[model samples]
Target: MPAITAENPLALPRVAASPDRAAARPVLAVTTAPSGLEGEGFPVRRAFAGITYDYLDPFIMMDQMGEVDYEAGEPKGTPWHPHRGFETVTYIIDGTFVHQDSHGGGGIITDGDTQWMTAGSGLLHIESPPEELVMSGGLFHGLQLWVNLPARDKMIVPKYQDIRGGTVKLLASQDGGGLLRLIAGDLGGHAGPGATHTPITMIHASVSPGAEVTLPWRADFNALAYGLAGSGSAGAERRPFRMGQSVVFGDGESLTIRADAAQDSRSANFEVVLLGGLPIREPMAHYGPFVMNSHAELAQAFDDFQAGRLGTIPAGAA
Candidate 1:
């Protein structure tokens, strides 16, 4: 769970919500993410599988890449593929990944680092472990989130952002019990480094055992809290949640979560990914890698991909 760290969290800037009159969000529901294999048999948890899309609007899907320790020479990654009509935000928490795209947007991201790629019109891309990491085979844990582009931005020019770990905006809980790493979007008046086609907020928090975190958030954005490494309770009522589970929050001005008194031995702190995004409220036609507004557009995407209009692998690649 080395998402990044500070020598002294209390020394960092502190952030606090409106604790006086702000209403804490209610826990709407909790869903466990099912385990599965993805991208050349790498382990994954479908973070939003059972949840309805209405609750995760403007966001398509998310995968929690292995928190598993792999034996030497056993690591794997996704082969070349095509995607359109969305952006993929990959945040590496404890390992390294190399990303490449046909649009000439790619880079290496390691622990606490991020790579944001927008497959605006379309593009071919590949994600894989570095050669050294593959040969050494160690722990690999990260997240990949698919954020949808509205109809107007779906066909715009593609781009990429390599956000270094040090660039992340770090904040301390008002009481200094939790460490908040803002990866993208806005929180209070502070902004993260990644620029998105849609309005969204992404955070990774490490809360000490028995500590609580309260965050001010945008009222219009839908909120979700996903457990990444340990047990915790979410919302005003304190609904329990653990690793691989997601908690949806009802409308409110602030979100709250508390670490369990005693956490699992695997991790020392309660690690959670907090996400909120403005709803696109548009109909979706999704098939495999393409997310379009209609079936006809999806068909056109497939046709274009088959006709080699999406993109091509660079010469002598890999």
Candidate 2:
């Protein structure tokens, strides 16, 4: 066996589904957009943002950090910043990310690892490539999702959950044709490692050629899936999807995904990240990194950050 780095090393176990499972949901719509640079010139594709927040409630934003190969000594990433009244989730797919916060919470999330931070009351943090990676040159790809907090829990205490790649539960398809990595919710009878304030499910799945899997989901939840790699069909719509496409689903209790084996012998597998949650439905006010229920609250957050009340990173702690 080869050595296991911080990347994926666990052999996902296959999970069989009972023959009497319910029908899968249907696709309601498909969304495609271009990614732009943000956070100090890092390229990113926004899956959901601004007015789309109302459509995908509880999810403030979903950014696909476009894959980029950084030459040695290249400078990139988000510097010190402030956040209030929300959560920031960083899922690393192919790089090392070093993070530090004012609350003294800090860690490194490598390939396949995840860092879920709750900037409830307030906090200052920075996310950038580790110095070694920057100096040596490497590839970086990942996703950053912002989850909105309900009005009642907007000011709760800040917290962090850094989950390593191997710790994430992986379930194989009943027919041994696919795999599902449960990151933040239950799937295939296996629960994710992180605890969430808002009820939500975040899963990453890859299906092999001609294999299919049906995943049960909450009927009341609003769900969306982004194609990470390859092409395949999803839900009852069975619509053809290519890379970089985001598919929204209609109300249903289950979701089905299949791989198009005819595409290519080596690239026949389909990969995606499925996310959803119970809509919060509350009015939201967002200003840069701060998310609140009212303009007054948003203003206060800015004031606090400027006054150094949100805390600060220790000297030379980057």
Candidate 3:
């Protein structure tokens, strides 16, 4: 099979939920994009971090990284860093990212690939564009999400899941008008590739103009949708949203997205990312890259990193 690329979109037929579970969910709130800022070394727009939202529960932060084109030899990407007590999900829509971590984990995530890293106790890592990409220059677009672990599992061993785009289960719209790629958790009888410490669902969906899709969602889980490209109405409220908006959903068993039929040809294909997870309602004591339940634990995390307790990537390994 050919590599999945943005120009050659993927499509999965949408499977309808049972009639009894098809109640329409409405938009609870629409979050505007925050000011773009330089993170580590690249331009990023934060969608929801603990600082901006009252409670995103299990989710701590979401960063939309470059959709910007770069000329050859341009500076790009994040250097080595430390993280603890959470999982980082990197979904690449375009470009390539080479990742190396203290746990001896390393790989390249290209278009349609996802790197789900569980920084259970702690881990040092680096994510940057491949040298070739940096040398030749190209477009880069992706999202990095930080997911909090429940208190009990916070100190578990770190792990990594590098999932290929083609391996993700795809669900098609009944009318053949859209596709949904399930990266984690289950959707429409399809199970995702990544196993999680917490229950969560990550879906990337693309809907052609005039397509309508309804997906069954766990009513108790906190759910939100990020408009990736084009424009569409979400839920029964028909709240109109364009690219770059984040829409939080109200409590209901089902969620929907309907692409605008009148969109210009260039913008007719609407793309979105839907995320939902059960809340880990414990206290969160966070310090920079570390997240723990108490100040003491947070302090220990830093001390450990300083003492080289978290493993290190060998020189030249990255």
Task: Residues 239-311, candidate 2: write the lDDT tens digits.
Answer: 8776677888777777777778765543446877889799998999998999999999999999999999999
lDDT of 3 by residue, 1-318 (tens): 013523433344457766787777778888766747554568777776323333477888888886668899974877788999999999988899999888888899998899999999889998888899989998888889999999999989999998999888777766667677889988767799988888999988888888888888887787888877788888887899867788888778889888888665544578888898888888998778999999999989989998999877678864
RMSD of 3: 2.8
Q: Rate the local accuracy (lDDT) of all candidates.
A: 0.92, 0.80, 0.81
Q: CA lDDT of 107 in candidate 3?
A: 92
Q: Judging by TM-score against the true structure, name the best candidate.
A: 1
By TM-score, the better pick of 1 and 3 is 1
Backbone clash pairs for candidate 1 read none
Compute each candidate's TM-score over C-alphas: 0.98, 0.90, 0.91
Worst 10 residues of 2 by lDDT: 1-10
Point out the higher-scoring one by lDDT: 1 or 3. Answer: 1
lDDT of 2 at 304: 95
lDDT agreement of model 3 with the native: 0.81
